[model samples]
Target: MEKIISHAISERVEFVLIAGDIYDKEDQSIKAQVQFYKEMKRLEEARIDVFLIHGNHDFLEQERDRLELPKNVHTFSSDVSCVPWQSPTGTKIHFYGFSYDKRHIRENRLGDYRKHGDADFHIALLHGSEETKASEHDVYAPFGLKEMKQKGFDYWALGHIHKREILSSQPGIYYPGNIQGRSKKETGAKGGTIVELSEMGATFSFFETAPVMWEKKQIVLEGKADRTEIYRATDELFQTYRDTLCSYVIDLEIVTEQASKFDADEWLQLFEEMRTESPFVWINTLRFIEKNQAVSDKWYQGQFLADELDASLAELMEDETFF
Candidate 1:
């Protein structure tokens, strides 16, 4: 949420639209709720209006009724509503949205929604999955891009999915994915989408403001095994970040079959010393494994034992306290 707000500030966006699922749960702690309100207040102070809707996680209930929000924050209830605002670029925009009353809404909510007729630009904010065989998401509240386009919406801002995607080419249908990745599975660059509207048409831009960045790097440790090769691989990985001035939560996976006298403990110690030299770089997860092929009949029990020792060392390198 902070990243979204910061990006909006930097880009000087007219207003921010949160389709749904603002909070992970309705019963979140008071501290979290308060902090959320504070950020909303900050956006409100900046004259930025926020249009929000309730998703499965943050379903509207009596508990949410008690909490107060800033005037700039407009939340849709059971009834569909349209809020009109003028952008700094002098484009008149109309935002139409509604929240799901229940966790599983089978019906197509967009069908009941009234269109903003004759508006310069009309945006429909919804939190549901598009009907597609390839989609692994629930069929609940299903709607299609063609259906949305036929309904006369200029742009459809969708949520509920954690991966950013542009669904339609003509009418400009988009899913902003998620504000931040909650786990490693939702790794890589996760962020929101920015929309620009005008009398001619609408254009879309992606803004990545995720607080925690996730990056996966594969380091090949093949051929002659030596300390120099390991050091060189680390340097290469670090050099990849020269273009993007951003700190990364990196998961380094080293694939090799070569074995040397240096044990896992020694390798970890060297990495720790290198980390001390450059505290800014972080190695969240490290996986080192030996690449093996088919076992030949000529391989004896002694060779098997040696291979087992190499695997053990690789596993030990994963532990931070191995040194």
Candidate 2:
């Protein structure tokens, strides 16, 4: 916490903007809440204003309203509100933000906010889906890149999509991703964005500040996989991390449809050997699925037996009903 504050202080960032989903949940533990407020306070003491909006996960409600926040921290209301910040460098930035009133908000919020022409740089900070087909997010808060760009905002900082991405090039649209990857699905180096705005234009930079990192590596075993094939794949994956120079937790997925001739014991032995070789790598999860080419004669034979059994059982049950 101190390190991040120190870094922000050194960077001399004008103000910090958290687009949305600031908390994993509104019911976060007291310890978590305290720590969050502590960091906000530290930033406030440093004379940096922090603006945040509620995400789908942390919708604004009576429960959230009860928590006490420092004066330096400001949250957006249900209605669209614009907050302006002036950097010591004499550059003015206007931030328009809003939080989801409920967990599911199916309305176009962009149309509500009046477009600002006075500010040097206009930023729209939101926690919603920009892609129409982003099924992973709430379908209600849908907006397109072109529409947002046409709205006349200089930049858009978006959230709710866990994957970090710059959605559009002509006009800036960024999903900084989540600060901390809560689960295996939210993998890779997760963090926020640092925007630098000036009279000339705006440049955006990404900063990874999460304590834990999530990475996924897919290994495919081609045709007729064996113990040696598994060992080779494991070795290749471990070798890739040799230059990382830090302890890493890796989630590996081995995908192939080819059925291996190796027995379960042999596979287990290979996995044990790989674990012994790479102590730094923690193989927390492993999934195995049979990738058989097509319906085999053996499978047909088993199906025939199953059909026969089903017929016999039906006949037996039909003849002898329980009184």
> Which has the greatest TM-score?
1
lDDT value, candidate 1, whole model: 0.71
Stretches of candidate 2 off by over 4 Å are 1-6, 63-66, 131-140, 198-201, 220-229, 243-249, 253-279, 287-323
| Off by more than 4 A, model 1 | 84-92, 134-140, 242-245, 258-273, 276-279, 292-323
* CA lDDT for candidate 2: 0.69
lDDT of 1 by residue, 1-323 (tens): 77778778777778888878888866767777788898888898888988888887676775454458899888988667888877777777788888877776656777776776466778888888777553333444678767788987777888777778888745768887776776555677777777876545557788777756777777767675577887788877776665564556667766666643446565656655655332244667776655553135325548658776765565444321121
Q: Backbone clashes per model, in order?
A: 0, 2
Instruction: Specify the poorest-scoring 10-residue window by lDDT in model 2.
Output: 314-323
Ten-residue region with minimum lDDT total, candidate 1: 314-323
Please report the candidate that would top lDDT against the real structure.
1
Cα lDDT of model 2 by residue, 42-134, tens digit: 898889988888887777886554458799888888888898877788878788888887877766677875666588778777887765443
Residue 318, model 1: lDDT of 33
